[model samples]
Target: MADLTGKRIVVGMTGGVAAYKTAELVRRMMDEGATVDVVMTEAATKFITPVTMQALSGRPVFVDPWDPRVPNNMAHIDLSRGADAILVVPASTNFMARVAHGFADDLLATLCVARACPLLMVPAMNREMWGNPATQRNAAQLRADGIVLLGPVDGDQACGEVGSGRMMEPHDVLQELIAFFQPKPLQGVRVLITAGPTAEPIDPVRVLTNVSSGKMGYAIARAAREAGADVTLVSGPTALATPRGVLRIDAHSARDMMSAVMGETPRADVFIAVAAVADWRVAEASAQKIKKTAGEPPTLSFVQNPDILATVAALPGGPYCVGFAAETEHLDQHATEKRQRKGIPLLVGNLAQDALGADDTTLILYDDQGRHPLPRQSKLAAARELIAQVARRLPAGRVPTLAARPAPGSPSAVPSAPPSPLSLP
Candidate 1:
């Protein structure tokens, strides 16, 4: 998420040996297309030269408040004008206390206090200095004043004695900055997502599965997390790493997937069925591997797997259902029919050959308003678009509970508190 394109940032450096790392931070921000302005305190010059930072940032670094650089002689006020954000990298304990106490002793403090932009503080100091009670109170006060703090990560330090109080790597700091700029489109929404291809075992070694790579699903999960949703990913077998901040549940077969989905769906605000589940599983899977006979191949019996999407959509007051259709031909017809049949509000369709195990996709979204084609793009971009679409279509408030179904063979029986078992665990 370190995509800082077109952003204007002021990177502030304070007195700390960790100021050496601030050069990399400024370089990285510039690499991400951000126009960076470096501001250094007097003590900061001892650790890293302003000339080095000026070369990296390709701009004059600010050192003195009255250095005659600004036409108005208000360098502190003019510097942050039109700026999107201000970052205090390698924020020393002294600077933290100064910012916390609103002391404008120098340009960094003056600009930070006078700026209208969002402020982020990246603390870097000795473990003892960071752990001091005064520093802790100052940090707390800054947080109370709505200042965002990145990290003084735990690791080996310049002083050679380390537990905590090391600056976060430049890449991580950029990621935090990116996240800060992202819009929380899915805030307070609980999303349950299914990903990958479910296996239907025929024997210990033989099974039926598909070519799904789970890339799209995982992308969607990551997008949802970025959008500030509480996400739970119910996944079949895949080698992909879990997205940050997403709770993942592993399921190997269609049955296991159903169980996991059922367990989590009730509390979800949205449910996206992206897993390619086996249509039929072996009725009685062999305990041992089945050997081929010389005369003929062994016959196998099959049974239908639970219809997870349809079952969830049919439930009383169920979450908003979104189904995926991977069709070889007649994509529109199949996608529309599937959406209607499953009683889902939205359906995403793409060619099986184009999407299966592929990073880029051309998606056709089917919904109440009709079909909309999204041009081919990377799965991550597509996922972001999809999340935006869902956020727009979400109801004003929670959907009202549906009328309860009558009990079997008893028309007058009262409704049960929970619906009947859709799929056995």
Candidate 2:
């Protein structure tokens, strides 16, 4: 899944038979953890009820420009006040013209004209209307104005004739939404990441593993991909879905994860070791499930597991290595020590109790320079910032052009303050 945990989106619906599809788009965005506000033109309400949209978005649907919902009767501006993006689904030919010509006759139109965020529109219309020279001219103008036009994908339309003008499927539009928000800072770079807790077998049915949910690692993979890196994720038994556009390899144990990472590290430009590998494994795992005997408990011998991060970092000319340290105490001390011990350029530290299996995280970056604290936020947001920080530290020739910073209204645009040392768990 593409992580949109803290993204704020405004789904602008225009009147079209495809207006029904906008409901699913809004639901999909919200499903990915984005907060969606549904804005509708009066003509749009004719196709889909405001009640249905409101129910899906969990916020009041805005349709009337003079709606009392706004303190100053400025629904047009207020609805998009802090939005990260404005997506117009089933953008009718009329709506396209209105937008291209800067018309603000309706609330939706007014919002488009007044929005400070990126405007993305998915067009839907009759085949002839889409082919009309006038509509083409309007589209050209929209493109010229920096308005992103997704598609009036060629296919069957609501009308009997089927040449072009079908709205992009809700899921496809959702993919575009994810792509639009992602900043491609690591483009042309290949990132190899290990995530989740590697399990070491005590027996066929029992194993030793940590509390890792793979959320942070998975979040990093998503962020890396969004940063335009070709990401390969080596996961250890995570229930989470594969992030879109990532190559995923599964690992069952520490040895398995090591093999996977070592195999991919040669081609990677960056390597992130986020998995919590078992520190020890049974010296000899039992082939059969160990049975408890009433007389005495079976004695199990243990041996040290391979140190994945240290091993990778020790490799000659290895990818820029980044390690993760989850400490319950002495976070800064341990994190800094680990970076030196592992011979890595960067090490990320967080409280194990605070981050394990959780959606939110507070991270501190430890390097030769000093400690840099990142504000507590969703793992996805933190991952993006982490990637940016890594990009900045990359050797000059290896670094790629990065996407611009998040716009002023985005949650990520919030200023960072030094986190209190006492806050570490």
lDDT of each: 0.85, 0.84
Which parts of model 1 are misplaced by more than 4 Å?
Answer: 15-22, 125-136, 152-166, 199-208, 239-241, 282-302, 399-425
lDDT of 2 by residue, 1-425 (tens): 44688889988898999988888888888889999988888889899999999999999998888998789999888878798888899899999999999998989999999998788889999989999999999988876666778777788777888888899889878876776566655756789999999999999999988899999999899888777678899999989998766899999999999999989988888999999888999999999999888888899899999999999899887788899999999899899988998999999999999989889999999988899999999998898899999878887664332343344234443223201100000
Q: Write the per-residue lDDT of candidate 1 for residues 1-425, one digit (tens) a residue.
A: 33688899999999988888889888988887899999999999999999999999999999999978788889899889899889999899999999999999999999999987778889998999989999989987876566767777899888998867888888778766765666656655789999999999999999999999999999998888777677899999999998756899999999999999999997898999999988999999999999888888888999999999999999998899999999999999999999999999999999999899989999989998999999899898899899989888877666322123233224232122211111000
Which portions of model 2 show Cα errors greater than 4 Å?
1-18, 24-179, 399-425
TM-scores, one per candidate:
0.80, 0.65
Tell me the RMSD of model 1 versus the true structure: 10.1
Query: Per model, how many backbone clashes are there?
Result: 0, 0
